[model samples]
Target: MRADRLMTIMILLQNRGKMTAKELAEELEVSDRTILRDMDALSTAGIPVVSDRGKDGGWRLVDNFRSQLSGLTMDDLKSLFLFPSGKVLEDLGLHSGALDTRQKLLAAIPGTFRGEAEAIWERIHIDSSTWRASKENLDALKTVQQAVWESKKLTILYEQADGEQNERVVEPLGLVAKGDTWYLVAIRDSEFRNYRVSRIHKAIVENETFIRPANFILAGYWEQSKEEFIQRLPAYDVQVEIHPSVMKRLYFTSKFVQVIKKESSSPDQWIEATLRFNAEQEAVEYIVGFANKMKIIAPKDLKSKVVSLANSVIDFYNEL
Candidate 1:
């Protein structure tokens, strides 16, 4: 752990030029005394760590000193290329920036490791889009992105969960891309909110800009919001019995179905499992798609709704 902290300190000083003991402690989630101890250890290890006193005093690496990132192994190089979050940059229309940064990284690495890193890109690829994912209509994406980067306010036509459209003027904070979906984190009425980029029909950047709060970390805020959103979502547990033939399909294909406890001992028979869904309607719609291959064992209301839909489907087909 101390080794990792020392490496982190070096990297931080290398990149940031200088940072106080308090700042380093805060950044590393350690105490100022621990930071001072780490600094002493770094100096003892022949790493030139310059320190000074007073308000402008902090820790910094000696100028022109380079680390051994160039000596990374083939696996390490491959790990660097295997970034699923690169999709986020692509969604934000920063694909060129991502590519340019990769190229620069390749140049920085030693020639021996560079070939292996470049090969990783060719051997592995990440497909972040879901099955049958629809094209996102983001006409306002550029306008919203501009607002986020420039710290400008924006007036937007946003579609709500109930499909009602409302005009909102907001201070854009950050943009988060989860797979193909994009969400704009913003401030309005002194409250933070998330707006789906696809739901934004129109966006006009306002001339006025606001000061971004110093302590607001975008990544941290997004994580907290994600947890809160998940907790707030309406979730219902469903008991289902699946035929062995479709059992694997249910487990692999459905995000709604999380196997709680498998009740089947044999491989060829019906397997009882529990699933979850955001709403009864959603559960009904998804289960109805499987036709006769699946059955809802409990939650009689959901079973009834699925039965009603299946009968309707049969009636329409019989009429033809």
Candidate 2:
């Protein structure tokens, strides 16, 4: 295990130059003393590990020193070939480049590791898109990506969820792909905002470039923003008794509904479950669809709405 940790330290220093002992310890999830000992071991092992003392000083490998990829273990080699979905690569226009990179890596690594890497590639695949054939309009994705890559400003015509269109100039920070959907994270009027790529009607990459914030990490920001968005959503809880047959279906429809908690089985074999929706209307719409398969246990208003909606549907059909 120490050998793996030592090799990881070397790789880290080789990739990201000048990491402080505290930083390295934090990254490797070890104590500072352990990192210092690892450094000593690397040095004694003929590794050119050096430490500088100053405000911005840290441990670094000597100039021109690079670790060999041949030192990677079988697991590491397998990890290198763990690619995302082909659709994701195509979205980023890296499908061909990804194929080329795989070939180059296979050619570059030692012959001993090549077979395992190639085998892993054939055995493993990832598809992050949903089952439904929903396509997003990404007409502005290329221009937005270009601005993000160039660290340039972007002027976009964005359509809001309410269908209101607005034009604004923003500092293109990064683009994030959540499943098949893409979002542009940018700074507009000194505030961080997320613009759905599908809603971006037009994008113009500005000639002027802006300095990227030193502390802005795209992944971290997106995660925090996602959490905040979920927290801000309106929660409407509904208690229901679902038939045995529809229990799995309730879990499957997770996008618009969340199963907050489940109670013990009812005497008649029905399942008591607590479900959450964004609004009362959403609960009414969903519960009404289940018809007799699901029955509302509490919240008299929701029961009334469902009955009223069901009768309305019945009456409308009867008229035909």
Candidate 3:
């Protein structure tokens, strides 16, 4: 806990500059004395962390002091790496070699997180298929990511979803993945765009340079295209309560529900709550089949729809 607290303090200072004992104590849930002691430890470790006492300031970093800027830390990699799932992907297809992903990532992580990172790498398995990238695409994703970091321009062979291909010079944004796909999020000719990494034939960094816009955030680009997914479900939110016994199995499964506002939860230690069916007729039919354990809830119209559908099914079967 102390080590974690110490790491927390460093990160806090790294993000917020500095803070008084009162602030750190309250935020970290430790006493003032403890905060002071932790500060002493940080200083002894030569963290360049500075503290000041004044009416105008609680604490602040030394002026113009800067730590080296790097890529993702051990924690960052761990979060991105995704466990158990990593183990699965090792067999599927994931690549990050000439991507120079490791060195850059190592540089980003703080010296403190190095150990935890090593342990995680040893324990976690990211199953990925052997990258089948033609030298061109393999080169393109690598170039695009590098250029984004270096602030440069890129000429890449990109194929759109409609099967169109062209060599376009674009400024890079970032990379994102969904299910088995990876995309290069970028700006081409002043327009924002996303290029699936698989379709890129080749990428070359042009000698030219480009200014990264002051107002750009990657998160804005990567959210799932909900409109595309919602088309698969019924008009309303379907509701189905699952039995508890199946909860653990469901929890262990990785669901890529492409588009669904379904849920599966342990209402107690014994019952699972699941909802999946947009149309009442469909939801009811699904709920009834699992009648021994599942229940339908909400949307009064759905109940009626389900009864009618069930009766119709019964009638059709009886006629047969």
- Best candidate, TM-score: 2
Q: Residue 180 lDDT in model 2?
A: 90
The candidate with the higher TM-score, 2 or 3, is 2
The parts of candidate 3 lying over 4 Å away from their true place are 1-139, 161-167, 175-183, 215-236, 257-320
Clashes of each: 0, 0, 20
List where candidate 2 sits over 4 angstroms from the true fold: 1-67, 70-75, 97-99, 110-112, 264-268
- Per-model TM values vs. the true structure: 0.67, 0.74, 0.39
Rank order (by lDDT, best first)? 2, 1, 3
Residue pairs that clash (backbone atoms under 3 angstroms), model 2: none
Candidate 2 local Cα displacement, residue 145, angstroms: 1.1
lDDT of 2 at 114: 63
TM-score head-to-head 1 vs 2, winner: 2
Write one digit per residue (lDDT tens) for candidate 1, span 1-320: 89867877776675567899999999889999999999999999999998878889988877635554745777778778886755566666766621245654664565556567878878888777666664888788889999999999999999998999999999999988787788999999999999999999999999999999889999999999999988898877788887788765776675765566668658877778788887787788878877777778888777778889889999999999
**Model 3 Cα displacement at 179 (Å)?**
9.7
**Candidate 2 local lDDT, 152-240, one digit each (tens):** 99999999899999999999899998989989999998899999999999999989999998888999999999999999999999999
TM-score of 1: 0.67
- List all candidate RMSDs to the true structure: 13.7, 14.2, 15.7
Give the clash total for candidate 2.
0
Best by lDDT: 2
